[model samples]
Target: MKRWVLTVLFLAVTMSSGLRADSSDQAAAHEIIRAQMQAFQTDDANVAFAFASPELQTKFGSPAVFMDMVKSGYAPVYRPRAVEFRDWVDSPGGPEQQVFVIGPDGRGYIAHYMMERQPDGSWRISGCYLEPLGEESV
Candidate 1:
């Protein structure tokens, strides 16, 4: 029947479009993380701060302050030697991106980045929790 054919066509298009959107989102999220990491490596706090959520930016007041906090509290993230992105998980707050990182001292860390979708539909880093990789896991 023509109706059945049209229904199937609509479903196919919708599913494909959804897939494309998800892939795009994933790419964008990964790019944000990469850019932020690059900024940190270069000591470009302003550039790095741009990738943060609005609330986070407000809380820090300035990029210098944010950078100071990162330097003191997230030393591994501030100077990660090896970085590998993992799965993106959905959370009630928004989405969380898992990143595997190796510090300069060669210790492994699992960084869970909480991402938020901005008003303009772009993603930003809301928060990050770094857990050291245990010997057994490594």
Candidate 2:
């Protein structure tokens, strides 16, 4: 009985400290990505740009410019037909979220999102790179 209680307590403590728990961060990132994608679908450049990190915002200078770049470059992520969140992994820069998406053109893509955690504990998308999946992949 004591061993079982201690085991449960150990797990609770570890999970609470985020030692083995990452759903909160992953879920928040997923929500942010979804909202940004929705904004893109609606052509709301301002709303979509708001989810970008300060670094990207500075690089683009304005939401219009950012939207233009996305429309021309990231077609898959700009208007995906379907999206599924995959793995969240730690990297040298930070945590990365991989999203599997079916593009507007019916092409499969994997979007790697580099997430930046702001000072206020909010996450922003620092960058996204869409890699086309092979014809055999889905």
Candidate 3:
């Protein structure tokens, strides 16, 4: 019923009119993502859930529900064996951070993280699109 699942699961990431992120934005964005990943690693659902946008938070209702959905549908993001920051694109929606990930299954994938800049100037993940890059690590 919501667009986040469909956007991440079914559609391919094809962001256009994007510009590379400046160093400051890149650092901040990457830091938040890495922190979220660490939260997942430690099973801190509340910490991990905080990285999501307010809109997403409301959609899932609670940290537990958000974590469950991520564990099931976003395996790579939830438990990435390896994570590499690729491109930080400034799209119409916001800054779209593309990450290269090695999944728990040992497959390679690209995670397109749609970020939202809060009024306070912090960032949160609004949506994500995961695509299979290859069987081998990239």
Candidate 4:
């Protein structure tokens, strides 16, 4: 009985500490994302592109291509007026992702942006899902 009780107590403490640490890391990632968005809004593509993962950079081939896609594809929704970031979900079986709620002119979308931590300890936006809320699951 004593062994079981101690085991339970130890697990509880360890789990609680882990949860706290995860929450803090999540918060820091959000801050980094907000800054990235600000850079994009200011048309500083270089700064905005700095947040992406190396794999993404190679896949897209060049930072300019990446930025162009972002500007044209979601530009309507992500324009300075409609974009707002909220909610973060560490991707299931994947990296941490963020939710951006965008709306204006009678249209809107919930964008799920996947992010990765850069060498400098900043989160960079790497991938995104531009879709209506609850419309699809993957």
Candidate 5:
């Protein structure tokens, strides 16, 4: 009976620790996305580009190019009036978060953002795909 109690206590502590770590990672990922969005709002291309993954930065070549691409292609993301972050899904490739946003025109969009974890234990935006929320009330 004593051994059984000890086993249960150990499992409880281990499970709680794991949950805390997962929650911490989620918070960090959310912050990174929020910071990037703030940068976009301020037209701070360099700060926004810094939140991107190394691969994304390399692909864009420069912050100015990245900002131009975003302004042209992702207008809603570039200037979202409202944003509500949803679930964080774990995948073999990386973690993805779903964000509900209302653009300046009051149209709703679902922004799916993929996040990559750096070797130094920081999260970065690897990619994002936005879908229009058709007829959905914001």
Candidate 6:
């Protein structure tokens, strides 16, 4: 990905890296989300599909069609500028789900991301639940 693209995405992903993940690793995961978001924002189906997990890619197969749905369903409220991972829950068989607070709108977005431990012992994101943080009415 381009440096500016990485810069934009890295801002949000850097938060996830702290204590639990770290700046670099979080940046990488953020890149995935960034690519997906950029695809939706720009209406670029190919770019968006490229960011999907292998499972999703296999299931959908058509980037344009899937991008249409993503644009229609999720492009409205995804203005994420910052992200902070709050809690880490470990399940016996399930992937670790991280609760996060995302800023630029100050809302909650939960990432049920699968983590893979690298040979160096650091964790990188494998997959995640990407959802918009809905606002609560006062």
Best TM-score among the predictions, by candidate number: 2
| Residue 129 shift from truth in candidate 5, angstroms | 0.4
Clashing pairs in 3: none
**lDDT per residue, candidate 3, 7-81, as tens digits?**
865544333222332667778889999999999999999999999999999999999999999999999989999
Task: Report the C-alpha lDDT of model 2 over 1-138, residue by residue, as the tens digit.
Answer: 999999999999986667347888999999999999999999999999999999999999999999999999999899888888988888788999999998888989999999999999999999999888975235
Candidate lDDT values, in order: 0.88, 0.92, 0.87, 0.66, 0.90, 0.54
6-47 in candidate 4: lDDT tens per residue?
999999999777766777667776776676677777778777
Q: Score every model by TM-score.
A: 0.81, 0.84, 0.82, 0.66, 0.82, 0.48
Candidate 6 lDDT, 41-69, residue by residue in tens? 57677876766655566676798776665
Model 4 Cα RMSD, 1 decimal: 5.1
Q: By the TM-score metric, which is better: model 2 or model 5?
A: 2
- Location of the lowest summed lDDT over 10 successive residues in candidate 6: 73-82
Which 10 successive residues of model 5 have the least lDDT summed?
85-94
Best model per lDDT: 2
Q: Write the per-residue lDDT of candidate 1 for residues 12-90, one digit (tens) a residue.
A: 9997777566877878889999999999999999999999999999999999999999988887789987888887777
| Stretches of candidate 6 exceeding 4 Å from the true structure | 1-23, 76-138
Q: What lDDT score is found at residue 101 in candidate 4? A: 52
Q: In angstroms, give how far residue 41 of model 4 lies from its true place.
A: 1.2
Instruction: Name the regions of candidate 3 deviating beyond 4 angstroms.
Output: 1-21, 136-138
Least accurate stretch of 10 residues (summed lDDT) in model 1? 129-138
Candidate 3 structure, TM-score to reference: 0.82
**In candidate 5, which residue ranges exceed 4 Å CA deviation?**
1-21
Better of 2 and 4 by lDDT: 2
